[model samples]
Target: MSVVPRVANDSDPDISHVRDRGALRLIACGSVDDGKSTLIGRLLHEAQGVLDDQLAAITRESRRFGTTGEDVDFALLLDGLEAERQQGITIDVAYRFFSTARRAFVVADTPGHAQYTRNMATGASTSELAILLVDARKGLLEQTRRHAAIVALLGIRDVVLAVNKMDLVGWSPERFGEVTAAFRAFAGPLAFRSVIAIPLSARFGDNVAAASPSTPWYGGPTLLDHLETVADEIDIGRGEVLAPPRARPTVTRRFAADLVWMTDHDGLAGGRFLLKTGTTTVPAVITTIADRLDLGTLGRVPADRLGLNAIGRVHVETAVPVAIDSYAENRSTGAFILIDRTTHATAAAGLVIAWLDAARDVHAEASAVAPATRAFVKSQEPLVVWLTGLPGAGKSTIANLVEQRLVKLGHHTMLLDGDNVRQGLNADLGFDVASRAENVRRVAEVARLMTEAGLIVLVALVSPLRADRERAAGLFPPERFMEVLVEASPATCRTRDPKGLYAKAEAGRIANFTGRDQPYEPPLAPALVLPTDEIGPEIAAERLIQAILGRIRQPTASDDASI
Candidate 1:
C-alpha cells in the first residue's frame, strides 16, 4: 500500500469530462470534541475540494482560533461560525460540497453538544448515511448513543464508524478491536444495515482518502473509496428502473408524523404554524399530540405536550392541501419544518409517517341517504354530549341516567362509557397521557359516527387533559357538541373510590393515575358543570338532559299533545 503525503495544490483530473455521478448526502455526528469537524476538513482537503485561496485563509484564521498549535487546523475549514471559532466547537450544522473522481458528495458537519441535538436532527433529516465519529480514547459516550438512535429513527440505514485520532491511542489494533466490538454490540438493536469501522488519524490523514502504511493489518477500502462504492451500489442496485409514478401532491387537510421538537416552548394540541416542506408551504395546525420516545429504553410513552428536544408523534392539519410523500420512500418530499407563526422561529422538524385523506383520487362512497334526512325522520337533531372529569367523578352514572331519560322522552340515544369502551374498543390502551389522548380520539370518532346515524351520543370518559377534551370537541360543530365538566375535588373522588382506583394509586400499584401521579385538567368553559359532590346523580342527569334538549330540535306542544 502507498501513502499520499498531505500536500497543497496537488493537481487532479478535471470534472467537466467526468461522468455525472449523482451526489450522496451524508452527516458527520458524535459526541462533543469527538473530532467530527477535523475528519470532515481532512476529507475535503485530501480530496482537493478546497480552493487554494480558501485554504490560505483558514491557515491565517488557524493562528487566531485553531486548536492545533503549529500545524494547519483543518477544522477551521468547516467551523465558519464565529461562536464556533471562539469556543473551538461546532454550534451549527456546516455543510460542504466535495467530490472525488468517482462521485460528488454533500457532507454536513453536525454539532456534538447535547444542547445542540436539534441541529444534529436537522442534518440527519436529509442525510442518507451517517459518519459517526468517536475519539479513539473514549470509545463510546452517551451522546454517541443518542446520535446513533436519532440516525436510526430518521431512516439512515448506513453508518461509517470513524475511530478518529488513532495516533493518540498508539494505533494499537487491540484498542481498535475493543472499540469496534463495543460499538457493534451497542448498535445491534439500532437496525443499521451496515456499520463499517475504520481507524484513522484525521490530523495526519491516515486511512482517510488513501491507504496508509501505518497499519499493515488494516486492509479495508479507504474512506473515500467506500463512500463512492456505496454510492455505486445504491445506484446500480436499482438497475435502470424507472422511478415510481408519483401521484400528484395530495391536497389534504391533515397528516400524522413523527416530530423532533426543537424549540424551548412546549407544543400542545391546537398550536398553529406554517408547515414548509420542499417548495410547498401551507398554514398548519397541530391537531393532536400522541406519544414521545423514551431514549433510554427506545420505547414510546404517551405525551400530552412536547417539550424542548422531545421526539413525539403528532397529528397536523393544514388549512390547504400540500404535496408530500412518506419519508421512508423520499426524504426530500417527506420531511417538513414547522415554523412558529408568531415568532417565525422553527418549532420542530417532522417526518411524514402517514397522510390523512391525502389521496385525492380516492373518495369515500357517499351514502344513498343523507345524515340530515335521517335526523328529520328521527324527529331530533343529532348531538354529542362529552362528559370529562377525574376518575370516580360520577360521569358514568350521570351519562346512564341521561341516556335513560332521553329514551323515555321518545328520543334515540347511545351511551359510550369510558370503562365500557376500555373493556372492548380500547382494551389495548394504557393510562399514560398518550393512551388517554388516543382513547379520547377513538371515542370521539365513534361518537361522530353514531351522530351521523341520527342518534344523540353521550360520551362518559375521564379524558384528563383539557387539550385532549378540546380536540374531541373540535370534531363537532359548536352547536352539535356539548362539553360537560363533571366537577369534583380530588378528596371527594378519593372518598368515593367507585372502582378503588384511588386505593391502587395510593398504594403505588397504578402509574399515571389521573388526579394522582398524572394531573387532570377540567374543561375551561364547559356547557354545564355537574358538581357531583353537591347534586345527586338523578338531578344532575335531569340538568344535563335539559341543557341538551335546548340544542336539539324538541317536539312541539301540539306534537307532544298528540303523543
Candidate 2:
C-alpha cells in the first residue's frame, strides 16, 4: 500500500483466485514512524506476492541503505524515493495491487508524518477499511488520534487498530487491551461500523499474513484471514473489488459536505473554488464555515475561517448541480477536494452527507440579463400573449395574424402554436391531463425565454384547463402576461372547423377530447374575449393587437376585464 487505494467488493468467496471474487481496499495509515511501510511490505513478502524482478530490485535496495543494516528492509519495497530511504520514513503514498486466494485487495500505504496529514486524508477518502497502525512500545500517538478523527470524518465505518511491533512490548495482551480501550473511548462517538484490534510484529511477521505460536492465547484469524472474510463488507464502495474503480454516485445530487481545509489560505464564506468530486470537476464556493473542530480537544467552536489542517462542515454551492450518492452509501463520488483556481493547489477535502439549497446555484449556472436589455430594445414591453380556447376556436389564426401585425410594425415577436410545438418540442407528450399540464408548462417556459429576448411571444394553445392557464401566467410578470380567450359554442365551432378536428373528435377517434369527452374551462378574468363566430379572423386579429398595444405601450386604468 503506497497511495490511497479504492476498494470494491460485494461478498466473500472461496480461498482461491481461480474464480472471480470480490476485492477490498485497505489503507495502512497512522502517525509518522508507525512502521506503515514495513507492515504492508511484510504482508506482501510473507504471502510470496512480489514478482522475481521486483524482489531482486528490493533486495538490491535493502543492501544499499537498509532500515535494519544488512537485514531485509521490507520498507524498501514501498519507499521508492532515495530521500525516503535515507530518512527511513515514507513520504509519498505507495499504491499497489495484491490478492489472496479467496479475495483480492487494493492496498494504500500512506505517510504518517504530521505535515503529510493531507496525504493520509487522500488515501483514506475512498478506503473501505482503514488499518490505523500503532507502535506497540510507544502506544497511540497524537497523530493516531488525528488519523482516527480523519477516518471518522471521512465516513469510513470499518476500522482496524493494528498494534505493530508487538515483539518490542514482549507480546503483552494487557498492553494491547490498554491501547485498544483508550482508542475505543476516544472514538466511540465517531460512529464507526466496527473497530477490531490486532497485535502483530511487522518486522518478525507475527500475525500479519500467518499466525504465531508464541501468542497461543490470541485466537482469531490472521490479517490475511480477516481480509478473506469480514462480515457485512460489500463491493458497494467502488462496486468492483477486482480493481479500484472511479467513484460514481447514482441519481442524487447536491450535498452538504464536511471539509478538511488543507491550504494555507483561510476560508471565506463567498470565496469561489473548483471542486473535484471523483471524475467530475465543478466550480464551487464555500457558503459558510460554521465551526472548526479541534482534533486534540474534540470540541466545536465558532469559526469564520479555516487555516491549514482545520476540519469543518462547510456549506458548498456548485455552479452546476451534480448527481451524487450520500457518503455513507458511496464513498467514491461522495468524497471531494477543493482546488484553488489561480494556483491549482489543493485547498480542501470534503465528504458529502446530504443535499441542500439549490436556488442560488441554479441561477449561477446561467447568465441573468437585466430588464433594461430586453425590455428596452423594441420600445415595447416584452410579454406573453396567451391565446386560450377549445379546439377550432380560431385561437391560432388570430394569434398568427396578431404576430404578423406586430412584426410589420417593427415589434419583434414569436408565434408558438400548440399543434406545431407538440410536433417537436413536446412530441413525447400525450393528451393525458398530466401531459397537457406539462405541455402548458413547457410553452410557458418558452414564452418566458422569448420575453427575456425582448420579443412578444404569442402562445396559441387549447389550454382548456383554468388551473393550467393560471400556472403559465404566474411564470411571467403581471404586466407582461395578457390572456386572450377566443369563445365559440362547441356546435358553432364544429360547423366552422377549418381543420375538421371536431369531426374527428366526434367520431371517437380522439379519446380525451377537450370540449367533448374532456372539460374546457373558460378564462374567468381574460383581458379580451373575442367571439370568433360573430367576428372574422382579420377583425379579431386587429382587436387583439389593439388590446395588447394598450398594455405594452402604457397600461391604463380603463383596461379592465374586457377590451
Candidate 3:
C-alpha cells in the first residue's frame, strides 16, 4: 500500500516544528479486545499519515473481515496478518509511523493476549511513554494491570490511560471516573510520573485526534494533542553517563542484566553461553542467577536456576568486556540475548541493569577514634557471635540466655534474633535466596557497627546457606567473629517445632523451608557446637558464655573509670 510523506517539502515550516517537539516512541498495550490496533489506526488516519490507496485497501478488506458493517475498519490497517483479520485480535507487535504538524511518532501496536506478554515487553523496552488502553465497558482487567506493571518495570514514567470504546459506555462521566480512579489507585506504587486518562471511542474516532462533541462535559486534551506535547527528555548526569565503562557501546566481558528465560531447558548458574547484544557476540557465562521476578506479585524472589519463560535477574561474565549501558538509559546498547554454547539456541532475552564493575567515586569517611580505642575504653573486645542452625534448634533460646548472662557479668551485649530483626529492619525482605543473602548482609553490617561500638553482638539466625554465613564472617577478623552451630537433627527439630515451622513445611504450607524444601549447609568447622538435642538451653548458654568470656579482654579498674 502507498503511504503519505511526513513532510511535503524540505523547506516546509512543519519540519522545524516537528524537530522542535522531537519524536516520541510509544506503545499501545492492554487486555485483549481493548481496541489497541483500532486506536493506533485511527490516530494515524486522523493525523493524515494514511494515504488514499492505503485507506482504499483497508476499506476493501474491511468489507470481507471488518467488525464494523459498511464502514472502513481502521484496525484492518494494522491487523496485517490474515489470522489477525479473521480473529479480530492482535497477535504480533505492529509498528506504525505517523506525524503531525506538532510532532512525529513511532507507535508500537502490541498484542494484548497474556501469551504474547513477552512481545509487549519487547515493544515497551524501547518506548518513552505507554498508552495503556482499557475497554471502558470492561474497566480494568487482569491483563491491564499486568501491562501496567510491565510498563513500570521497564521504566516508562509517563502513561496515557486511554479508556476506549466510550460510545459503548455512553460516554458516561461516572464510568470514566471509575476506570481512571481504579487505575490511579492500582498504579500508586508502580511509580508512574503521569497518568492522563483520555475517554475515547477508537472505532468511531471520538476524542482520538480531535475533541469529541459527544463528551462536552469532559475536559482534557485529545489523545493526539497530549502525545504531541509530552516531554520525555531526562537529565542524565555526567557521572551517571560516564561512570559505566561497560555501558560504552564497546565490547565488555562482564555485566548484570534482567532477563526472561525462553527455552525449555533450565539455565543453571555457572553455565557457559554466548552473549549477543547489539553488534557484539562473545562467549559468556551466567555467573549468578541473582533473582527471579515473581510476576504474580511483581516481587523479586531468590532463584538458583531459570526455568522456561522465567523472568530472572542475572550477572553475566563474558570472555571480554562489553560496551553497554543500563537498559533504563540506552535501549540500543542495553538489550541482549543468551544463546546455548553447543546448540546455539537462544536461551533468554536480557536487558542490562548494570556492569558488575560499574565504578563509584564515593569514598568512605573514617572515624577520628579507632575501634581499638573504643574497645580499650569499654574494657572489652568487640565480637560477633553468629549462631546458625535449623528452625527449632534452640539457637534463639541459647543466644538469649548467653546475652543475659553476659549483661549480668557487667558486659555490653547486643542480641539480634532472626524473628525480631525480620519484623523491623529486614521487614521488606522475603525468604528467597537473594532476600536471605540480603538479610544476612544487613545483619552482618549492623553487627560490624556494633563491634565498632565495643559491644559483643549475638546474631541468632537460621542462616541456611553456608556461603551467606561465610560472607558475613568475612566482615570481621578471625578473632572478632565466631561461628557457633546450634546442632539438632531435622527429626529432633521437628519434634520440638516451637514455631510449628517443620509441621507447616511437612504439610506443604511453607515454601523454601530450610531442611525441607531448601538446603541448609552447616558450617564446616564452627568455633563451637551446642547439640541442643543432647543439652538444655541453660547448659548451651553457659557453654557459649564461657567460650565468649575466654576470648574477650578482661576489664581493668582504669578501663572502667575511662568508660
- Please, what is the TM-score per model? 0.60, 0.60, 0.56
lDDT by residue (450-539, candidate 1, tens digit) is: 988889999999888766666667667789999999888899999999899999999999999988898777776899999988998999
lDDT of 2 by residue, 159-190 (tens): 88888888888888898889889888888888
Off by over 4 Å in 3: 1-21, 232-252, 263-272, 304-310, 329-332, 340-347, 355-563
lDDT of 2: 0.76
In candidate 1 the C-alpha lDDT for residue 161 amounts to: 94
Candidate 3 lDDT tens digits, 423-457: 99999988866677668878988999999998999
Which one wins on lDDT? Answer: 1
Q: How far out, in Å, is residue 125 in model 1?
A: 4.0
Model 2, runs deviating above 4 Å: 1-21, 231-255, 358-563
Which pairs of residues clash in candidate 1, taking residues 3 or more apart in a chain or in different chains?
302-434
lDDT-based ranking, best first?
1, 3, 2
